[model samples]
Target chain A: MRASRPGMSRALVRRETIAGYLFLLPSLFFFLVFVIYPMFMCIYTSFFDSNMGKDAVDMFIGLGNYKELFQDKIFLGALKNTAIIVLVSVPTVCAFSLWVSSAIYNMKPVFTSAFRCIFYLPVVTGSVAVTVVWKWMYNNYYGIFNYLGKSVGLIDSNINWLGDPKYALWCIILILFTTSVGQPIVLYVSALGNVDQTLVEAAEVDGATKTQVFWKIKWAQIMPTTLYILIITTINSFQCFALIQLLTSGGPSHSTDTVMYYIYYTAFKLYRYGYGNAMGVVLMVIIAILSAIQYKLGQTDS
Target chain B: MTTKKSALYKIIAFVLVLILALLFTFPLYWILTGSFKTQKEINSTSPAWWPSEWTMKNYENLMGKMKAPLWEVSVPFSQYFTEDGTATVVSAGPQVPGAIRWMLNTIWMAVAAMLLTCLTSALAGYALAKKRFIGRTLIFTLIVCAMALPKQVILIPLIREMSSLKLYNTISAVIYPIVGWPFGVFLIKQFAEGIPGEIIEAARIDGAGEVKTFTTVAYPMIKPGVGALAIFTFINSWNDYFMQLIMLSSTKNLTISLGIAKMQAENSTDYGLIMAGAAFAAVPIITVFLIFQKYFTKGITMGAVKG
Candidate 1:
C-alpha cells in the first residue's frame, strides 16, 4: 500500500483484509452454526407445532405453545421447583463460600494454599463422579449416611433419602451446594486479596474490633465479587440438570424438577419441540432480566 | 498495640477454618478410603474410617476387566458362564473396561475443545482489545450477551442441528459447540485490554506484520489470561455431563461423567465399586489442577479480575 499508484496497492490491502477474514472464518462459522443460528431456530420453532418424530414441521401455531405452557402443570411445578432451589442454594453457597474465603484469607500462606486446593477439589471433580458418590452416600441400605445415622443414634432405621419426595429435593440441593462452594470461594479469595491493606491497618490502629474491620472494610471491598457470584449462582441453580437427571430424573413425582431439566425432557424424551422451545424462551427471559439487574447492581457497587 | 487480641481472634478463625476445611475435604477422603476397602469391609456394621485391609483386589479386577480387547465384552458378569449348560449369571455390573474407554474419550474431547477455545479466544480477544476496527464494540457486546445465555436454552436446537449434520454420538458433537466460545473470548478480551498499545505499535513500526506483532508482542503479555482460559475451559469441558449424556448414548461413547451416571443408574447400592470408580475418575482432574495449582490460581484471579 506504500505505492503512490492506487490500483495495485489497493488490491494488496484488499488481499490482506481478505486473509484476516479467512483467519476469522472458522471461529465465526462455529459460533453461527452453534450459538446464533440455534438461538434463532429455537425462537422460530417455538411458533410451530412441531414434534421430533416427524421430519417436517407441522402447521404454524403462533403463541399456542406459550399459551399451553401456562396451563402445563408440570411446567408450572418445574418453575416453582427451580425458584425454590435457586432461592435456597445460591444464598447458602454464597454465604458458606464467603465465610470460607475469609477463613482461608486469614490463614498462613502455605496452609491457605493447602486449604484452597482441598476446597477447589470438588469443582475439579467431574459432575458425574460426584453425583455417583453422593448417590451412593444417600442410599437407604449400604449407604454411608444411613450407616452414620444409625451409629450416631439419629434415626432408629434407615430412611430412603433419594426415594422420599420430601427429602429428594434436599438431597439434590445439598449436592449442588457442596460442590459449588469452590467457585464463589475462589472469587471471594481473589476479592479479599485485593482489599487495601492500609485501610485495614488504619482500622486496626483506630482500635476497631476485627469484626468491625472486616465488616466495614473487607466486606465492602468484596461486594462486586459477591454480586458476581450471586448472579452466576442464581443462573446455575435455575439450569441445574445433570445431577438431578442422573440421581432422580425429576423423580418421586417431579418434586426435584428444575426448569432446565423439564426443557431437556420435553425436547428429548417427550419430543415436544414446540413446548420445549417455549419453556426455553421463558428461561432465557428470566436469566436475561436477572443478569441485567445484577449487572446494574454490580455497577452501582463499583 | 492490640496484637494479643488479634492473635486470639486469629486462633479462633484458624480453628473455625480448620473445621470447615476438613468438612470440605470429607467427601474426597471418603472416596479415597472407600476405594481401597473391599465391598465387605465398606459395608461393615461400623464403617471403618481408614481401610483395615488395604487390598489391591478391586484395582486388579477393574484393570483386568478394562484390559479386555475390543473394549466391550457383553457386560462381563453375565457372560461368566458355568462349566455346565446352565448360565448362572446374576448382576451385570458396569464394565470397567468400558468406563476406562469412556474416560479416555472424555479426556480427548476436553483437550481438543480446550485447545480450540484458547486459540480462538486469544486471537479474537487480541483483536477486540488492540484493534480499532469497525464494529468492535458491537462484537464485544455480543460476546458479553452470549456469556449470559445459558447453554440449556440453546441445547435442544444445537442437538437437533448436530443430529441433522450426523455429528451425534461422536466426540465432534461435544467439542464443536464449545469451540470459539464467547465466554472465554469475553474473559480474554478483558485481560488483553491491559496490554499497552505502544508495544504493538512499536513492533509494527519495527517491520513486524500484524500477526507477528500479535504473536510476539501481544500474546506473551496475555499469557496469564490464556493460561486461565485453558484451565477454566478444560475443567468445564471435563465436568460437563448434560452435553455428553445427550450426545453420546452408547456406553462405549460415554465420558467419565456420563459413565458415572450410568453406574449410578445401574449399580444403585455398590458403594465400594461406585466410590472406586469415582475416585479413579476424579483423580486426573484433581492431579492436573494440583500440579498446576499456582497457574490455576493465578489464571482464575486474572479471569475474575474484572468481575
Candidate 2:
C-alpha cells in the first residue's frame, strides 16, 4: 500500500509505518500467540506419538497416525458420516433459506423483520439449550413425536428416535438444519433487499416469467452471498458435534459419529492425541480444498 | 418488484412462511412451557401442549443442585507478580446456587471479551484500512485467510498452550482466543474503509497525534461498527460451548450452557429439571439478542462482505 506522489516524503512514510505497527501490535500479539502458534502446533504434533500424558515424551512417528487412520474402522465410519452430513446439509440449507428469504424479503418492513427474527430464534437460544429441548421431543416412549404420531396414526408404536441407528443421524441432521438456516436466511434476506429493483422491473416488463427473472437476474446478483452461505453451511455441517454429543454421544454403534465428534472421542476419551491431531489435519485439508473449489465456482458463476 | 403476482401464489407463500415461523419458534416455546410443567404431565405419554400447573419446582431443583461463591476476584496474569508464583484468588461474595454463579460468570466473560475485541479491532482495523505500513498487505491477507478456517482444528494445540501459560481451566483461555479471532478485525476494517482518506489527513494536518486523531476523529465515526461487534461478541461468547467446555472443567467455572449440559447428564431422564436449566440458560441471551438484534444483524452482514 505504498503511495507515489510528487510531494510524498520519506519521513511521512516512516511515521505512518511506525503508527500502523503500533496499532496492529495488540491484535497481532493475541493472533500470533493464540491462533497462529496453535495452528502450527496442530500440524507439528500430528507427526508424533503424543499420547494423553502431559509430561510424556512425544516420539516422532512421521505419517504413522495418518496411516493408522485409514485402517481404523471407526475413523472411516466417522469420515463417511461427516461427508453425508456435509453433502445433505449444505445444499438443503442453502436452497431452503434462499426460498424463505425470497418469499419474505419484499414484504412489509415489520413483517420482514418479524419473520427474520422468528427464524433466528433457535440460534439465539444457544445450542445446548436447543439440543436439550429436542432430546425430550425425541424421547422414545413419551416424546411429542411419538405421541402425535400415534394419535394421527402415522405410526403403530413408539420409536426410540435417538437410540435407534436408523433415525438417529437423520434426527441430528434435522436439528442441525434448523440451527444452520438462521444465518443463511439473515444473509439472503439482506442480499435480496440489495438486488437491483429496476432490473427486476425491466425483466418483468420484457415478459420474463418470475422464475426466469429470479434464476437469470437475481441469482447472479446474489451469487457471492450464495457462495458464502454454501461454504459456511458446509463447514458447519462438517463440524456438527455438540448436538451429537448431547443427544446421542455418537451412540447406537457410532451411527452419529461425525469427524469432529470422533476427534473429541479419540483425543480426550481414548487418550490418542497424535491420532486426533492427524484427524484434525485431514479435516482442515478437506475444508481448505472445498473452500478453494467453492471460491473458484463462485468466481466463474458470478 | 412485488408486481403482478398471482393471488393464490401470494396466499400460499404467506401461509407457508407463517407455518415455518411457528415451527421454528416451537423449541423456545416448548422450553418455556416445559420448564413449568409438573413431573406427572411431563412423564405422560400424551404431550401436554401447555402446562396444567406452572410451578417453580424445576427452578428450585436446578438452583439446589450445586452451590459456589457468587464471585471470584483474581488477576489474569497476577501469578507472575506474586511471592509464591501463584495467583491470588480471593472470593468475597456469599455462596449462591451454581446456576446463578454460572450465569454471572457467563455475563462477565462475554462482557470482557466484547470490550477487548472492540478496542483491539477498532485500532487494528483502522490501521489496516487507513495506514500504509510495511507488512500491511501481508497482515491483512493472513487475517482474511484465517477467518475462513475452522477454529476447532487448533483446539488441541490451544489446550497445551493454555496449560503452559498457566491459563488453563480459567475463563481467560476462552476470552483470549475469542478476542484473537480476526472476524471482528475484518468487519471493522470493512467499516473503517468507508471513512474518507481526506478526513484523516485533515486531522493529521491539524497536528493531532496518531492516538489523539483516532480517539477524537476516527473512534466516534466507527462507533456503530464497534457497537455491532460488541453485541455480536457478547452473544457468541455466551453461546460458545466448545471453548468453555474444554477450558473450564471445574463445576464452579462452567458457563450457563455447560451448566445445562452437566445437569442433563446427571438427570438424563429428569425432563422437568433439565427444562429449568435450559430456560435459565436460553432466556437471558435471547432477551439480549432481541434487544440489540438490529446491530447483531448488521454485524453478521458486514462480516460476510470479505476481503
TM-score top scorer: 2
DockQ per candidate, 2 decimals = 0.44, 0.73
Q: Would you estimate the TM-scores of all the predictions?
A: 0.89, 0.96
How would you class the docking of model 1?
Answer: acceptable
| Model 1's DockQ score | 0.44
Q: Candidate 1 local accuracy as lDDT?
A: 0.78
Q: Give stretches of model 1 more than 4 Å off.
A: A1-23, A54-56, B1-5, B43-46, B60-96
Q: Write the per-residue lDDT of candidate 2 for residues B1-307, one digit (tens) a residue.
A: 4454566777799899999999999998889999999999999999889998889999999989889888877776787688765578865578899999999889989999999999999999999988886788889889977877888888888888887788887888899999999988888898888889898999989999999999998888888888878877888888888788888888888899998999899998999999999999988988888887888778778767643
CA displacement after TM-score superposition, residue B29 of candidate 2 (Å): 1.3
- For candidate 1, lDDT tens digit of each residue in A171-219? 9998888788777887788789889999999998898887899899988
Note the residue pairs that clash in candidate 2.
none
Sliding window of 10 residues with minimal summed lDDT for model 2 chain A: A1-10
**Residue-level lDDT for A180 in candidate 1:** 80
In model 2, what is the error at residue A38, expressed in angstroms?
0.4
**Which residue ranges in model 2 land beyond 4 Å of their true spot?**
A3-7, B1-5, B75-86
lDDT of each: 0.78, 0.89
